[model samples]
Target chain A: MAEAQNDLKYLPLNDLHVELGGKMVPFAGYSMPVQYPMGVMKEHLHCRAQAGLFDVSHMGQVILRGCAYAELAEALEGIIPQDVVGLAEGRQRYGFFTEAEGGILDDLMFANRGDHIFMVVNAACKAEDLAHMRAMLPGIEVVEITDRALLALQGPQAEAVLAALMPATADMNFMDVAVMDWDGAELWISRSGYTGEDGFEISVPVAVAEAFARALLADARVAPIGLGARDSLRLEGGLCLYGHDIDTSTTPVEAGLAWAIQKVRRSGGAREGGFPGAVHILEQMTNGAPRKRVGLRPEGRAPMREGVELFASAEGGELIGHITSGGFGPTVEAPLAMGYVPAEMAAPGTVVYGELRGKRVAVTVTKLPFTPANFKR
Target chain B: MKYTEDHEWLSLDGDIVTVGITEHAATALGDVVFVELPEVGTMVSKGDEVAVIESVKAASDISAPLDGEIVEVNEAIVDAPSKVNEDPLGEAWFIKIKIDDVGAVNDYMDEDAYNDHIG
Candidate 1:
């Protein structure tokens, strides 16, 4: 199809996606490719079995400078629950922008790049996140890096492919960040990705992005993957999408993201009760959340999509919860979903029914990450 | 064989009309993961939703082209929905209906006309 309406922004790889026969669609206020000629199934499977390249330039990348890294980390901790002050140089941590009432503003990844902190936020939440950072920490500069294009090279062969060009990437552990120079072009490469695979997210200047993407695609191990496969891969990996699985109305504890909060940010720790939602979030951590996010596996073939209600039984069961994200898991070879239900019914083997097309289809509650995460530690 | 605007193809044999989705529809849908067919003996009017087909990315409704009673449903395709993608017009036929009015089949487009319409 033709690119979305003129109002939508285009990614740097838009033309290349079209040239590769990608089906373009409107996503997060941008015209993007949902899948290429191989379709989402093949693209998702390719990432699990081999390697896949993703154009994630739509995600917001920003640099926090004009202050010491330690001071910025403490200032940032006031909004997020993570122990940012303890983050080592060249290491990254995943956390969320939490509201005063304990609701998540947005999930983000921030790396302590020594001189400055490098942050990446979801595309849909970038504008507001940047504004929040600017308003919350007045003196520190939160500079949006719009001149860079981010690409994710993920899967079993991702390191091998990147090692061919930058041998230093092979030595880096998961969540390591390094600024490397290749052919005189500066690149910031992070050993992390949304997919549950060993990978790297490379931030290259827009001027050399096209050539860099082409060079990566030239590698036999890497195939161009689109947003469709990216969603499926993250879903199977049990990662939450910003708007669907986790949102402004959901808290980290309720969303089952309590693990992201290190001990330093919790009750009785050195830096406890300092973040925006510390009071309520720590309460939930000490006690328990009313609802918990859990994975759902359909017993049959019908794919349960977002907004499908969940029931406790197959015959006139009590309403339990609603599915937030659901689709066929290409790797699991079955339909999988994630949603929030009463904490009592959040066990892995709990039998629940998903209402599909006016019928109750049986499903089972399971632990997150339908597929085992293969992140290289 | 004839085709409807909705991309369903019908092959008439005596009073029973066999129905399946066209190749163009299958290609657009990518992979077929599930098929929910109407029960046999159910009466359906033209344009009524007679079946539901799901792919990894989306779910689609298969509509009836003519008023008819469902005489037979494709159990094999329901058991293994990939057949709809493998052979949409052959072994993947959805249902056979005893059409209420046989002359209604003439209203559908022939092969050449259907190809032109899609283009």
Candidate 2:
């Protein structure tokens, strides 16, 4: 843990990770656990079959408080591609901060609690995100929660385990939010996660973070998970990692995120544009982009990783595109990958070749979610 | 018995010494998630990384303790890498080799020497 510890600040549960016998590592600029005593494989299977608790305190938690929540929403809608203004109270939605050229800045999670919006951004991009938010929405009070700890309880059994601690949490549906009292401290729980399973991302004050973590882990079904299984689990779900899938070079349309940009934002009808990349985003929405992000399922046991070249199998391996994300899916029991190919070659069942270690391996452009996602409805 | 500072234990039988990662090395690598072993007949040189073993966070290369021709491999390690962590000395032996010199085993560190070398 000494060599793995980062100079960056740690969450309240940092000691707990050490107690759980985690092999800590530096990830996204934070010292986090890569695996626990059960190891990566066992932890991965546990998340799928049962529930796993993750300490994700490094992510940015912004509390937007002001009288003009609608005004703030409209302003946020300008920079991101999501239908934020149309979001109802107590609901969560996914969207991204776009670069001025329509490139994705970062993918983020937003929960609209009517009076204020509690937003969560990736750990790596928290600083840049805060600066971006401040630059775009002047006078809108946004407080970065540095003294808080975030935890994710994921998998099918996650609900039952969390329900035991916070009984009211059981009634919360998917992509919903609830302001609950956890041992007296306020906790913001979102019914969402990245592992393609039913789970909740909880934000608790640093003072009560450890107690909350232990309380949930008291249930037999819940186990403390690390970052290794977390990566494999999300990869199997076909979810895009911030740096890998959606980056500053990719646009919402190019990343297959056009659906996130509501029609109202594009048309400038009701709660019209104001965010950073709105102008370019609306243009992309009106006129289809040149290339869009699509999923790829390579036919072979070999895993296709990011930056692996993709080519047409017919033209003696003519260069088509490259893979962005890929891995061996434990659930699907096969290797899968995703990448941006030529629009014509992006269809599912389209035969493609992925060059790995210089050999062009056969691949198929198949539907995403190689494994069926059991997200709670 | 000779061993590399990397904690590989080599046992010499004639001009051959069985090579395997130490328990310390296996535990440090965490779970034995994936392994890429060299061909059985490939000629390996001293200090050449002939095998790739990956855990969740790090990947380790098993070096040839001394120059030798690979004679046999422990396929059970490939079947279940966790054995490397559980029984590194017994069932998780990586590969056996016909060494270039029977005396090379004397050059490697013994159990006490390796224990101190790691410290």
Candidate 3:
């Protein structure tokens, strides 16, 4: 298949995906591989049991630089909800860009790389995210690295596969960032991943992207994964996919992401932080968080797919919520989903019913991270 | 032994025509993650929905090539859907239908013609 191009752009590995017999689809503007030769189910399972590689170069990688690390952090907190002011050097935090009405702009990962905040965010939301940052942190500079390719080597053998190429990187723990020199490329390597597995996300220049991808695949242990598998893999891991799970309309609290808010940031008049939705967010944090997010395990052979209606109480069940992401989890060997219900029914062990084809299917409210997370913390 | 233009193969010795997805079709479908079987003794018409086959992308309905009644089903694909991806023409038969008119098999394209059409 020829590489597809639109107003956005294509990754350097886009041609490689086509050459590898991948079914490419347009996602977030760039033509992306949705499934490859092994297909989505096998790829999903393979990533769970072994290892799979993903070309996530479409996501915008940015660098924030201006002043001291502390000053830069403070500048960043002007827009985002995380207490960037308290972020230690060389440490990373998961955070959100919030709107005034307590809605999330986008969920992202931020790393304090000593001098600047090195961050990666969803491809679909990158434009707005970068603009939001530039507008909010006027002193700090934001650079969009479009000439780069991001690949995620995710699963149990992630570190091992990466270790073959970068010896010291393999030793890095989760959320740690190390800029290592590989083949004349100053690639940034992070022991981080979306799948609840041990993995590394590498940022290589477009020129080296395909070669690096080929090098990784040369190891019989690594397989080329596509977007379809990526979705299922993250879903099985109980991680949220940006558009499907959270968007500008959803709040971090309602999305069950209150844990990411630093306790100090929530303290009233603490450092007088200027962040979006800080007031409402602190209120939600101080008082109990309403409408917690929970994992749902449906009891049956049929899948309680996304957009399916959820109900509270078993008999004469009242419609209360809807599934955001749902699928048959090959790893868990059952139908699974992530969605929201009333705060009361969001607790683990709560019994609820999902209406599929007008019949109420039995489901049990379960804790998030339904599958045990294997991140190398 | 016969094939349909849509790439379904059937071999009939009597009223029962052993059926399975064609190799070409299976290869295109990639890995089959789920296979739904029609109940035995259920009446089926030519071009009627006989079963459901789900790959990683989405579930698709498998239609019958000839009018018949389902006499047996290959439940094996339900347990191991990848069997279709590996050996679609041999072991991944969704169902065997008792043909209402054995002559209807003639309506289906032959292997040579089916291959030509598929190609």
Better-scoring candidate (DockQ), 1 or 3: 1
The local lDDT score (0 to 100) that residue A82 gets in candidate 3 is 83
| Tens-place lDDT digits, model 2, residues A242-357 | 88888988888777787777776666556555656667766777786677677777764556778888888844746778898776565665667788888787778888888865
Candidate 2 DockQ, CA atoms: 0.35
Where's the lowest-lDDT run of ten residues in candidate 2 chain A? A2-11
Alpha carbon lDDT at B12, candidate 1: 99
Best by TM-score: 1
TM-score of each: 0.97, 0.90, 0.90
Residue-wise lDDT of candidate 3 within A1-377, one digit each (tens)? 34344364667887899999988788888888988877777788888888899999888899988788888888777778787878776667888888887888888888989988889998889999988888888877899878888999999988788888888986788888888988898888888888888888899988888888999999888999998878777887888888777776667777888778776666664754367877777777777566766799998555666788888866684778888898777788777889888887888899888887557888898887868889898
DockQ of each: 0.74, 0.35, 0.42
A-chain TM-score per prediction? 0.98, 0.94, 0.95
The model with the greatest lDDT is 1
Kindly report the docking quality category of candidate 1: medium
Worst 10-residue lDDT window, candidate 1 chain A? A1-10
User: In model 3, which runs have C-alpha deviations exceeding 4 angstroms?
Assistant: A1-8, A267-273, A313-316, A357-359, B1-13, B17-19, B45-48, B64-67
Q: What is the C-alpha RMSD, rounded to one decimal, of candidate 3?
A: 2.9
Cα lDDT tens digits for candidate 1, B1-30: 999989999999998999999999998897
